[model samples]
Target: MARSLLPAPDARGPFSPGFWRSPLRGTWFTSVLGVVLLAGVTVLFVTGLLSYAAYNPDLSPVNDKTPDKGILGFYLFSWPTDPPWLYRLTQGVHVTLGLALVPVLLAKLWSVVPRLFTLPPARSLTHALERISLLLLVGGALFEFVTGILNVQLDYVFPGSFYPLHFYGAWVFFGAFLAHAVLKAPVAFRNLRRMREGGEERADGQADELAAPRPDPPTVSRRGALGLVGGGSLLLLATSAGRSFDGPLRQTAVLTPHGGPEPGGGPNGFQINKTAAYAGIRADETGEEAWRLAVTGRSGTVRLSRADLLGLPLHSAALPIACVEGWSTSDQWWRGVRLRDLAALVGHDGPVDVFVESLQRRGAFRHAALRANQVGDPRSLLALSVNGEELTPDHGHPARIIVPAAPGVLNTKWVARLTFGAL
Candidate 1:
C-alpha cells in the first residue's frame, strides 16, 4: 500500500458547508450581505430602465420637413409631471445606494476573498463554470460601481461617452448576475431558510467541510460582522444623503460628494448646473431686441419678439426642473406663453411635439425635443420669465422651454426656436 503526501481537497458546496467554522465567514453572514448588494443592484437596473424609457425618442418624424438624419432627441416621452419628485426619488436612490454599496460590497468581497485563493480552485467542469460565474459577478460589479460613481461626479476620465459605455456595461453585468444567481440559488435559499429556523442544521446530511484543525477563530462573531457591514452602510448614507436631502450635512459639506448649490438661484432663483458663462452663451444673443423666437410648424413659420410672446396669452406654473445630477427646485414661478399657444400660430391645435433650439451655438445640449404630452401640457411654455421677472440670461434669457416633469437639460435653456408637428 502506498500513501501520497498531499493536502486534502478543501472543496465545499455553495454557501460552503461548515463555513461557520470561520465565524465571520458563516453562511448566514455571506448570504445576507450578498442579498443586500443583489437587491441594490436590482433596483439600480430597474430605475435605469425607467430613466431610459423616459427618454422616448421617436421613429417616424425626424424633423419638421424630411431631413437627412434622425434626431435621437432622446426627448421621446414626457415623464409624468405629476409627482415631480418621481425622477428625483429614483435617481436619488440609484446614486445613494450606489455610494453606500461602496462599503457594503467591499465588506462582502473581503469576507469571501479567501475563496479566491482556495487550493485546487476547481475540481470539475461544473466547478470550473461556477468559478467563471464568480469572475463575472465580481468583475461586472466593480465596473458598474466605479463607472457609476465617476459619472455622478461628472468625471469623464474614461475613453468614451458615459451614457453608451455605462449602458452596455449594465447589460453585461446583469447577464452574468443572472447566470450566477441560478447557480447559487439553491444554496442561498437553504442557508436563508436555516437562518430563519434558528440556524442549527446538517442540511443534505453532509458532514462538516473543515479539517481537524479548523481555521482560526474569526475575530468578529457573525452578529458583529453584520453590524460592521450595516454600520458602514449607515455611515455612508449619513455622509452622502445630504446630496438629496437638506439640512446640516449640506451646510457643512460632510462626506456628501455630489456638490452644487441648492436649487434656487438667479433673480429669486434656481440652482444651475452650468451658468451662462460656463455654457459659453454670448450675452448679446440673449438680449430682448436681438432674440426672436421662430416658431415653425406643418402649416407655416412665424417669428415672435419678446413682447409678441408676452402679448400672447400668458400663464404660470410651479414646476421643478430636476437635474439628473441630483438636485431639484420646486415651486418655481415660471411664466411664459403656453407651448400650445405657440403651436396655434401654425394651426396645430391637436396633439403636437415641439423641437426647441437654443441660442447657445455650442455645447452638448444646445437643442431639445419636446414630446407630445409636454407640448400639450398647459404648463409647458417658451418661458418669458421666471419668478415674476424676466429671465436672467443664465436662466434661459429671452425665451426658454420649461416643461413639466422634464429633465433640466430638456427644459432647453436659451431657447431660440420652436418647431411643431403631429405627435
Candidate 2:
C-alpha cells in the first residue's frame, strides 16, 4: 500500500497509507473544512456572548434587586437601547449559525475520528494537551449544539436547568476553543497559505496512493462530501431564519414554531408564548377597576390607574419585541408614557438604572433591570396599548414595559411597581 507524502511523526501526523486512500481525507480537504467550521463556531461564540450580555448584564450593580445574584453573568455595559432590531440580528445569527453548524461539525468530526485511535495517544505534554483540547472541543460543541437546538425547540429533555448548564458550559467550551486555536495555528496557517497559492498539488506518489488497493474506502468524492455538508447548512438556514426575517421565507421555516404571520388576526395577531389562560390569570381579575400601575423611586410614590396613566402624555413607538428564544415580532406600534418621563416624576433626571416589577408571582423573568439608556429612550414606554388596542391579558394587560433593543422578557409584562434605585 502507498502512503501519504505529508510529513508527520509516526502514528497519525499525516503520512499514512490508509489515510491517503480516502480522497475526502486529504490534508487540503481537512484544512478547508476545518476553516469553515472554525468560522461558524467563532461567529456563534461571539453572538452568544452578546446575547448573554443582553440578558444578564453581569457588570451592572443595577440588578441588585433580582434573583440569581452574582452568577457569572458579569458582562458589563448595557446592551444597545436603540435600533430595536439589535437583538433580532445578534440572536438570529446565534441560532442560525448554531443550526447551520450541525453538518460542518459532523464533517469535521468525521475527518478527525481516525486520530482518536492513534496508539500511545500522548507523545509529549503538548500532545496530551492537544488531545485534551480536542476532547473539550468535541464535547463542548456537541453539548452546546444539542442543547441549543433542543432549547430553541422548547424541549426540556435535559436533566437540569438549561440556562445554567448552557451558560457555564459555554465558558468552558470557549476556553478550550481558545486553547485549541492557539495550538493549531501553526499547521492551520501553513496549510491555508499553501492552498491559496495553488500549492495544493500533491507529490507524484501521493495521488497514486489514493488509487491503491484498500479495504472499502469511501466511495464519496471530496466535492460530494462538501456539497452534502453545504446542502445541509443551507437547508437548516432556510427552515430557521424566518423567525427573524419573517417574509418570503416564512413558509420554508416550518421548524420554527414562531415563524409565521401573527395568527391571532388583526391587532392581536402575533406569536404568543404564554397565554393569559395558561398563566392562571382571569379576565375578571384584570379589570381596570382592580388594575393599578405604581411608580416609585427616590422622589416619591405615585399610583396611576389605567385612566390616570392614559391621562398623562402618551407617545407611540414602532418597535420590535425580540426574545432569546430565537424569534422576534415585526415592528409594531406601542403607545404609552415615555419611561424617562415617568422616571422624571420620580426625581431621576440623570442616568439611572430602574427596577421593573411585574405581577407575575412565579416565573424566572417577572422582574428586570433597565439601565440608563433604556430608561432614557423616548421610545421606551410604560406601554398601555399595542398596535392601537389596549393590551390583551396575554400581552400584559393594564400596562407593560417596552424598551427599544431590550429582550422581550426584560420588557417586564404586567408591570406593577417601578423602583429607581438599589432596593
Candidate 3:
C-alpha cells in the first residue's frame, strides 16, 4: 500500500521515546504508586462525601451548596450526632491525607508523564478510550488537589464559590478516577504480587514503553525512589497533621492554617474562622440590649433577650469546632441552652429542622439550616459561653449554634434568629 496522506507521527521532543530517561520509569514502579493511590484516594473520596453529608445538604437551598448536584448527592444522609467528633475525624483525615498524598501523586505523575507525549496517540479503540480516561484522571487529580490545598490555606484566589466548584469537580474527577482504576487495577495488582513473590527485578519480560530505551545511569534505584516518595509523604504528614489536634502537637502543623496557639488569651480564645469585624457585625447590633433572638415556629414568633435566654435552663457540652480548612480546636467547654430548648420555645418540643440566621452582614453562611436530628440532639446548643466564659465577639458573642459533628460554618456564628420546622 502507498503511504497515507496523514502526517507522520511526531517523534521529536517529548514525543520521542529517548526524551524520557529515568530508569525508574517502568510499569512496576508506576503500578506500585497506582496501587497506593487506589487505597488512599478511595478513602479520601469517601471522607469527602461524608463531609458533604455532615452539612445536611438535603436541607436544600440553605444548606445545599450544590443544589444542582442532582444524583451525585444520592449518598447524603441525616448526619448523626452520636460520635460528636464525627465531622472532625472525617474532615481532618480528608485534609491531612490529601496533603500527605501530594508527594505520592506527584511521583506517580512523573512516572507516567511519558505517556502524555506518546506518538500516534492511539493504537486502537480501546487505547483511545483509555487515553481519554487517563487525561481526565490526571487533570481531575491536579484540579482537586490544588483547589483543596488552596481552601485548606484559606486562599480564595480561585474564581467562583468553592463549594459548588469543588463539589462538582469531585464527582467528575471521581468518575474518571474510578474508570481508570478499574482498567488498570489488575495490572497494578499483578505487578505488586510479583514484587512480593521475589520477582521484583528481571521478571517482567513485556515490552515496557515506560522504560527508557537509552536511560542514563541510575542516580537512585527503584526502591530508593519509592523510599523518597514515601519519605516526602511522611514529611508532609508531620508538618500538617497536627492541625487537627490541640496542645503541643498543634505547633507541628506548620503547613496548615490556624495551627498556632488559640488567638488572644483566655478560656474563650480559640481558632475563629472570621472575626465580627470581618463579618460586618456592628457593635450596636450584637450588644446585649440590642440583640434579641427571634424564634418562630408552631407557636408563631417570640423574642428573647440575652438575659431571658440565660434565665432558661442552661446546659453544657464539650465539643470541638472543626473547619473545612482542616484546623480544629480541642473539645471546648460550651455552655448554653440546648438546641431542643430553643426549638421548644418555638413550640417544637420534638425533633424539628431549624433554620438559623446570623447577624453577619457580609460573607456566606449568614444563615444555615440544621436537620431535625441536629436540632434535637441534647448536646447541640445555642452557645452563650465557651469554657465557662461568655463568648467573644469573634466566637459569636450574642449567640451561636454549636451542633455536634457539624461543619464549622453550619454552627452559625452571631446567630440572630431561629425558625423551627420545615424550611
Provide C-alpha RMSD values for all models, in order: 6.0, 5.1, 2.7
Q: Residue 115 of candidate 3: its Cα lDDT? A: 76
Q: Could you tell me the lDDT of residue 311 within candidate 2? A: 92
List model 3 lDDT by residue over 57-111, tens digit each. 8885778778888889888888998798888899999989998899999999999
Q: Model 2 over residues 1-423: C-alpha lDDT tens digits?
A: 112243345644333445434556655666667778677788988888788778645534443223263545555456877677998788888888888879888988777665665545566788777888778888988899888889888898977877767776787788888887776656666666866776543532345222323535578877798899999999988888887754456556787768755557667666666666665666665678887778888878998888998999999999887878788777889999999888888888877778888777665667778877778888999999999898887888878888888777788877888888653
- After TM-score superposition, what is the CA distance of residue 183 in candidate 3 from its true location, in Å? 0.8
Ranked by TM-score, top first: 3, 2, 1
At residue 49, give the lDDT of candidate 3: 91
Candidate 2: list runs displaced more than 4 Å.
1-22, 59-75, 196-218
TM-score of each: 0.83, 0.87, 0.96
Query: Over 4 Å off in model 3, which ranges?
Result: 1-10
Clashes of each: 5, 1, 0
Give candidate 2's TM-score: 0.87
User: Which candidate model has the greater lDDT, 2 or 3?
Assistant: 3
Minimum summed lDDT over a 10-residue window in model 3 is located at 1-10
Among all candidates shown, the one with the greatest TM-score: 3
Q: lDDT, candidate 1, residue 412?
A: 83
- Local lDDT at 174 for model 2: 85
lDDT of 3 at 277: 95
lDDT (0 to 1) per candidate: 0.69, 0.75, 0.86
Poorest lDDT segment (10 consecutive residues) of candidate 2 = 204-213
